[model samples]
Target: MKALCRDCFWTGDEQPRRCPSCGSMRVVRHEELGVLGIAHLDCDAFYASVEKRDRPELRDVPLIVGGGVRGVVTTCCYIARMSGVRSAMPMFRARKLCPQATILKPDFQKYRTESRRIFDKVRDLTPLVQGLSLDEAWMDLSGTERLHGAPPAVTLARLQADIEADVGITVSIGLAPNKFLAKIASDLDKPRGFSVIGAAEATAFLATRPVGILPGVGPVMVQSLEKSGYRTVGDIARADLRDLADRFGQHGLHLHRLANGQDSRSVNPNEARKTISAETTFNEDLNRAEDLEDQLWPLCEKVARQLRAEGIAGRVAHLKLRRPDFQIVTRRRTLPVPTQTAKTLFAVARELLAAEPKGQPYRLIGAGLSDFVDGQEAGADFFAEGERRALKGEKAVDILRAKFGKGAVVTGRALKKE
Candidate 1:
């Protein structure tokens, strides 16, 4: 067993009620403390935490970070979460559940800046940082003990403390022998926590848990598994791998391995991005194709901005629409060649949108680009001459927008209409 004082960073043996040196009670003790290397780090209510940090008035209060009444909650503070508020819950419903909570708009740019700063701090601890998203990642701190003069667990705890002190945010970490188990452990504690699950207790601990606890098992798959009489990890663990494979095909093999707490997936730091996209839900459902195009244009611009920032281009454009009745329809079209301009993206997306029978109102719209390649291959001759001209115009506009502001350069039609 090992015990460490969080405040003073003191590592010692006895698990005293208080740290012997600093006299602080925020002490953490664990059996596998020093040996574990892989870790999963997730920020504590990230969007909401940033809001609380910048606006101290909302610190102790229940807070939600989202959009208009029509939009959904991007995230909420723990206090709001206690009232059944959750991420992706509609803002209207979240407000009714916690009527007194403060509601704030999401400032994505500010959040991105802070996320990078926090990531840099984590990289200082280890280079095997596999970012899962802006607020979560898997990090392998193997072979770091010689450099840090401490075990991976202690280094991780100190990293969390450093973020809280310097970045004004707290994170929860999960430590285990591999990526999957480490990710599961991280969620066992939250807000500001460090939890561990070692190889010794892994199988036994996972046995009684529901099959839904596995990473890829969603509600639909859980229902299917339950109907087949396999309700828990123990059931799958006991079942024959061949039998599972016969039932679920390739996925059954995956299930059998995970049931025994075996994960072959590694922490990949250089995972390629498959797609980049953004979507927005309307305050009132939109029916007209023109109205949908209005929403689609901005999303395409956003995707183009990301493409430029990443220095990549994509061959295919994707468009998504959700009807008022919750039926989702998606369409994708590959260009004659790849292009990154917002003009080309919108042209392709506009064609797809025109083909959809659009009398029914749409609650959501999204645009994305995929099938990536180098952005240098994206300019003239690859697309229609009209599109080529628009690309040049958009590039000039992009520069002007960067010099001034996005509002300074807007499409003539869009400005007069909106």
Candidate 2:
């Protein structure tokens, strides 16, 4: 099949602006559409969409989900996005741009729950699913046509429909010959979009695009490349590989390969997450350990909750402090046993904080867990009876929190004085 209607799932060999069978303008046509199986699926405005789903009244209105005025926006609905509000923009600025927007504090627990439901649906289709975040993932349906009795494209269309039907959320999909191109295709169209990229057109498709579109080519790298007379992907593709390597080292060689539409990376389902962490910049600098500890408590809980959600435990607890002068101080402690409990993480982080010099003001303090192992492997025989009991109690609290809202169970340490 050379063409498929995203809305109707009609397949044909001819390329048309609209599907001949269903008349949907959302038609994806490519030379390799039938052969390509690597895919990327990204939720559309994930956080905001979840909020809107829970509150149907917000569905048609502009919405922004984030922290307080002093904080930054996590995500905004398309209506707010059209008014210049964007993710990571200061809340104050976003409000100014979309004053009518309904602002809501983020409920990560809710988002995580919804994300898990969506991921479970994806996993049902293929075992080779690689989760990128709470809302995005990469899947390889390379050889599942016989099992599903349909091509990968048709299976993905059904998956998209299933997500919307069951999860109450929309997703955009990209099908391509490789991961890099699949990622690029996923962004070509968004908010319930389906796009495809094929091997035959990958090189020419990337040529006119800016080099910055390639992964890892940030603003600084773009400026450096432009200064060296390489302004576009086409330029990088035509440049001498040896010369590019000499100038930018291995990174240049990597860029050259990507520019020519070459990426050998596979979608590994068992890829290890380097770290799981949570951090927040304070509205004001904190000098006392008590104040820092209060802030650190919630962050530790957040990290622990993430570990539980991912079904992993960490062997190292990490503490990070940022001084007022922008100097960063990081401390790590290797635990005797891996843990996924917030109480254990906070205890270790608190000790690490106490070991630091007193009266040194910090603008930010964060906590993290690293060196992950399966959750079953954590808190094994190495943990004492008391520790095991504490873990059991914490797991019970987790169940309560999941049943109700996150506020269903709050530790005293996480409580804030009004």
Candidate 3:
């Protein structure tokens, strides 16, 4: 088919100046739109958009969804972006940029509800959806043509419309041969967009773009590549494999592959979440050991609850602290075995925290788990005896919390925080 009308779902053999059927100019044309299957979908300004959706008065107003004066901007609406506010900008800086913009604390429960509704529609199309974040994901529609009775592009276009109509939010979509190129295409346009990049022109299309466009090419890597006389992706694409490997080792070869539009990673539905964590900024910088421990317990409970809920356990426990001046410190310990127990999480995290300098003030505190494993391992014969008991103990608490409310049971240490 020559083009797609995003509004009316029209397809034909000739690309028209406007969608012939609807006469709407929101038409997309690409040579490989019919055959490509791997795609990336990203919700536009998700947090802010949800806020606007429920509060119609805020539809045209600038909205920022985040935390307190000391916190960072979680996200802001497009209208706020026009005034120079952006995600992760310091709250003070964001206020300076858009003084008139309304600021609301993040309502994650509401956001998650909306996210589930949106992805339920996506899962109805294909089960091969891999979430990159709450608002971003990679999708494989390779074999779904038979089920959907249309090409992936047409299916995705309808999906996009369905999201706007059903979920009251807009999403951008990128269709391409692989994950890397699809991700790049998703960002080529903003708000509500659909773009495509085919294998035939991938190299030439990426040639002039900066090396930083490739994944993992941060500021430091960009500086190193430029100093090595490699400025554009074309430079990396044309460089010899032996030369790249010799100069930068395995990472150089990885860069070369991406510059040439090669990404072998699949859209894996079961891809593990890398980490689960919870943290809180203090009202006052805390120096007392007792006060810090009080703060730490609640966070441990939060992380453990999520880990168990997701049916996963972590092989490592992590402790994080931020000093008053914003220098962050993170400490992690490899566990004897994976655990989803609050007792295990707190025990390991407490040891890591205690190792910090005595009476040192901290502006924030947190606990986390990583290096995930299946939660079923807790029942394995080889699983440690102590962790198994700890798991059982927590399961009792989980049962109580589920029956009553989260506040039905709480640790003495957490009560101290209360």
Candidate 4:
């Protein structure tokens, strides 16, 4: 299939303005479309889109999802973007740019629920799915044409349509010969876009793009490359490989390969994350340890819930505090046995928090668990009977919360006021 209409799923070689079957102009045509399998699927303005989906009244209005005035924006709708509001911009600045925009605080639980539904649909198409975040993922649909009775492109098109129908959100898809080009192609057209990059055009397409477009090339590295007269991918493509290797070591070699549109990395489903944490930026700065501890309880519960959901346990419990001046202080403690229960996580994190200098006002508090192992590998008997009973009670609370809602049972510490 050299051409497919995204709306009707019609296949042919003819390039037309609209699909003959459905009369929709959403057509995707490519020379290597039928053969290439690697794809990147990115939900458009994920958090904002979910908000718009739930509250259709805000569909046309500009929306920004973020924290308080002192916090940064997590994401914004296209309407807000047209007014120069961007992710990571301070909420105060975003409000200034889009004065009429509606600002909503992030509801991560809702977002995660929607993300899980979307991912389930994706997994139905292919098992080789690598999730990058709640909004984006890389899918390897290689060697599945016979099973699906269609090429990867057609399956991907159908998947996009299915997600929109089932999840009430739009997605952009990129199909290419490799992971690198696929990711880049996905961003070429946005909101509800389908883009393709063939092996024959990868090098030429990458050469004209800025070096910053390459993955892992951050602002600091861009500045360094610009100082060396390397601004575009083509500049690196034309540079001496030996000189680049000598200057930047292995990283330079890696960049050189990517500059030439060569990426050998596979879409591994077993890619492990480095850390899992939950943090909250308070609307008002908290000074007293009691107030901080009250806030800390919920965050600890969140991290524990995530660990249980992922079937992982951690050997280290971490505490993080951001002072009113934005300076951050971090503390960590290693446990003799790994755990996925909030009781242990909170106990360790509370100890770490107590060790910090008291009376210093903090604007943010975070809890994290790291140095992971499979949940089954965690030694539960490390705690005495009473402690174990408390842990079991927490697990029971988790079940009730899942069956009912998050408010099914509230811990005394969480409800305690400073």
Candidate 5:
């Protein structure tokens, strides 16, 4: 067994109640701590933590980041969690649970700024960083012992220390042989936690946990699994794979593999970004397409800004509309060539919007781009040389916006009032 003190970075041959050097009980022990390199780093109550850090008055108070009365909770601090406040719960319910909780609307701009700073720190640790989202990432720290002069465990402790000292935020890290287990362990102890699950005890460890603990196993699937007597990962692990496949179709095979810790998926560096999208729920649904288009233009610019920032492009443009009744309608069109241009995305999306029935009110409307490739490889049309020139002009406009400001270049289409 190997043990390390998170406080002092002391290594020992065996687990101890407290670190010999620092006399701290915040010790982490693992059989493969030095060897395993796959890590999942998740920030602790990310949005709420940021809010508390900036507003000292909110430190001891329960905090919730969301919208008005009709909106859902985006996130809540640990203090609010004690009162059963949870993410995605309706704001009405959350307010009822913890009436004292200070509701704050999401500051996306601030969050993105802080997230980039955190991301830079993670990349400094290893280049094999795969960002799962703005708040979490997977890191592969293998084959770098000589460069760092310490194992991944010690290096991770140092990272935890740096984050708290410099950023005034905390993160929980999980170390395991694979992404699945690492992701699971990251949640075991949160708010500055470092937990590990070694290969030897992986199966036994999973057997005791509920199948709902598995990624992608939602509430509906959990109910179906319970009806089939597959309440725990133990049940899934013991069941015949062919039987599971026969019952649940393709998903069954995945469940079987994950149960036994048989995930072979590599930490892909070029993880093709699947989607770039954003949506907002209005205080009240709007019926007029003009008002929606007023909102849509900014969203298209946002998506385009993100795409250009990442130096990526998309061949498919998609439009999503959610009615007040919760019915979601989506439409997509594949372009003749990939693009990262706001103009291209907005044109196709506007066409899609025109095709939809306009009389019905919508609570939410979103647009996105997918089927990605390098932006540099896009904009070349085989038949239309003029279109290519137009795209080149668009690229130049994007560069100008990047150098100057977003308002520096606004398309004529966006200026037209619907």
Candidate 6:
């Protein structure tokens, strides 16, 4: 087998404890290292890392990026992770766990700027890079060996180092033949890691893992799978096709394929986002429709801002409610035309909210826009004159908010106390 050093990017035939060229202990050896190219790159502790990068004094301190007494954590540094502070954990619990940790409100605009820089670097290597989020992406580097004068592994190692050097943060890389395995491999190691999973060993590798490891298998699905005698991936991998199909329909077939280490989806750089939305968990559940509407307005504004940022418009407006018991209720409406304005999003979602059964307290409220089209399409001949007015008015406010501050403009409904 051959080995490579992540630090020095030195390759040698004999597997050793350290790199002979650089004498570094960060050595990785695999029989199928060079050929595998489909890769997933995840920035380590993205928001917290960016925060620490900007504030050198906090480099060694535990840092968390989130706010609000009731809001869930957005992200936390590895040091905070040691103290049981995790993303999406309640802010109160996080404070109890890491009392000394420095918590900061999220700076999304700054983070997005940094994200573009990082992604641009990846595009330098391969235009096939598909961003899953601001902090993570999938890349296809197949057939680029001659261009870079090295295999995908070596090029990726160099890219990883380049990212850390240029961006001032570390990232982990997972190299595999397909998307499913690649995603799993990325999380095997933390902070700065490089893991590889080959097609040859994928089946045996996934067999022992729990069914919950597979995508789309939530807590409820896990229970259903357990009851169906499918506790592990191996069970599903070996299950009779007809039996699985009879029991689970298409979902069973999907589980069987993924369990056996198969993912046919290709890397798509132009993959259109299906939705742009935001939601907040309330400090306390409220049963009143008026209170929910107050919460819904901010989320509509948020989604509209996101849609505008992405230069897209959605023809579908959606509303979501989660009860105290975790039961979810969703409502959606098709618009006369696509829109990317807070007023339109709010109007559609507010109407949907009014139609839902009354007297139901919801612990969470979310709204989003989907069924997208380019922003240019929003001005089409078929576009309603009212929607055009709403978009124009919202754009003017967006400009004002950008120049002045987020508080530059506020709705009458926005003043309603939570």
Residue-level lDDT of model 5, residues 40-100, one tens digit each, is 9999999999999999999999999999886789999999999999998878899999999
> Which tens-of-lDDT digit does each residue in 1-418 have in candidate 3?
7678998999887788799898999988887877899999999999999999999999998999988776779999999999999898878899999999999998877998899998988999999999988899999999888899988999999999999999999999999999999999998898899999999999999999999999998998999999998999999999999989998999999999999999999999999888899888776789998888888888888898888888988988999999989889999999888888878888998888889999899988989999998899753547488888888988999999899998898877777788
Worst 10 residues of 1 by lDDT: 379-388
Residue-level lDDT of model 6, residues 238-356, one tens digit each, is: 99999999999999999999999999999999898777888878888888988888888888988898888889989999999888877788888998888888888898888988888
- Candidate order by decreasing lDDT: 3, 6, 2, 4, 5, 1
TM-score of the candidate numbered 4? 0.90
How large is the C-alpha RMSD of every model relative to the true structure? Answer: 2.1, 3.1, 2.0, 2.7, 2.7, 2.1
Model 3: residue 87 alpha-carbon error in angstroms: 1.9
TM-score of model 6 (CA atoms):
0.93
What lDDT would candidate 3 get against the real structure? 0.90
lDDT to native, each model: 0.87, 0.89, 0.90, 0.88, 0.87, 0.90
Model 1 pairs in collision: none
lDDT against true structure, model 2 = 0.89
TM-scores for all candidates? Answer: 0.93, 0.88, 0.93, 0.90, 0.90, 0.93
lDDT of 2 by residue, 289-322 (tens): 8999899988988898778877899999999998
The residue-level lDDT of candidate 6 at 293 comes to 86
**Model 6: lDDT of residue 231:** 98
lDDT of 1 by residue, 1-418 (tens): 4777778888887778788899988777776777889999999999999989999989899999998887889999999999999999988899999999999888988998999999999998877889988999999998899999988878988899889999999999999888888998989878798888888788898999999998889999999898988999989888888888888988988888888878878778887667888898898999987788888888888898878777888888999988877778999998887777888898889999899885978989989999998877776454467766766787788899999998988875466448
